[model samples]
Target: MTNVLILGANGQIARQVIAQLKSSKAAMKLTLFLRNADRIKDIAPADSTIIDGDTTDTDALKKAMKGQDVVYANLAGSNIEAQAKDVVSVMDALRIKRLIWISTLGIYDEVPGKFGEWNNKTLGSYIQNYAAAAQVIEHSDLDYTLVRPAWLTNKDEIDYETTEKSEEFKGTEVSRKSVANFVVHLIQEPNLEVKHSVGVNKPNTDGDKPAWY
Candidate 1:
């Protein structure tokens, strides 16, 4: 069985990712590392392995990260760099190279136009931390896919596009559901998503980065 370690399993993206994972091939095993076991238990797969602890606790995280084919980080906005660094270190020690990291668009000045300007202002502090975290992953030897999702929306739909990190991506926004589905695609395809900083957003969409969007 392919054992995969998922950090920050309690977050929204992680939650949606878990749902998609449930329908994946049975040869896969999802081990979720979360701080709150109670809530995680409530929604996680019945067959999934669960680890309750802090990511900063290197010993604990390393223990869970071992013997896994891939590790996906869905960490919160606060202290993202530290969490990502810690996860990367654990993966490094274990020699686990496949990484699926979730980052926001515009982190590397990839977001374009006036929308990019607003995205920075709206998510300035968090974007910097995520940008630094992306740099950390870039410099690592691991096979990584830095998914730069546009303004995350929690819609029930799954229609979205995967762009080539062009200037047009800065203004494009995607639904959380679509990103989750994309994660599942990456998980199944492996290196297909490797070494790429891809962007996800709704197609043919443009204008003032919708506040309600």
Candidate 2:
């Protein structure tokens, strides 16, 4: 079975990923990592292991990552780069090579026109920090897939499209459910693609900004 470790386990998208994984038929073992496992104890699948600790704490992260085949992070914040560095360091020490990292669109100025302007203007520091984190992962020796999701919403349905790093990002927003589905797909199909930064969004939603914004 593929042993998977999910960091920031209580996050909206991360929780959705767990829910989807629980219903899947893939032979897998899941470990949920969070600073406060109590927040997720009741929600996580009974078979999943829960680790309570900070991702920035190398010792804690290493312990949680031990023997894991894949690491998926749904982390955020201004110190994201620092947190990612810590994760990378521990994973490296443990010789864990597969990483699936969540990031955001507009990090590379991929969004065009008003949407790009608005995203950059609104989330300047967050975009910068996320970019730095992605860079850290990209330069690491681990086989990684960095997902850059557009503005997220709590929509109940899942419908999304993707664009590679070299392509211009399209659409304005995508549902968190869609992003979770994509992440679960990656866990199930380990070799689909690797070492690429992908942009995901809802098709035909191209606009100046997310509708909710």
Name the candidate that leads on TM-score: 2
Residue 134's C-alpha lDDT in candidate 2?
Answer: 92
Tens digits of per-residue lDDT, candidate 2, 1-213, equal: 999999999999999999999888998899999987899987788889999988878888888999999999999888999999998998899999989999999888889999999999999788989999999999999889999999999999999999999899999999999999999998888775699899999999989988888
lDDT values of the candidates?
0.83, 0.92
Which predicted model would earn the best lDDT?
2
CA RMSD per model (angstroms) = 1.5, 0.8
- The CA lDDT at 91 in model 1 is 89
Error of 1 at 102 (Å): 0.6
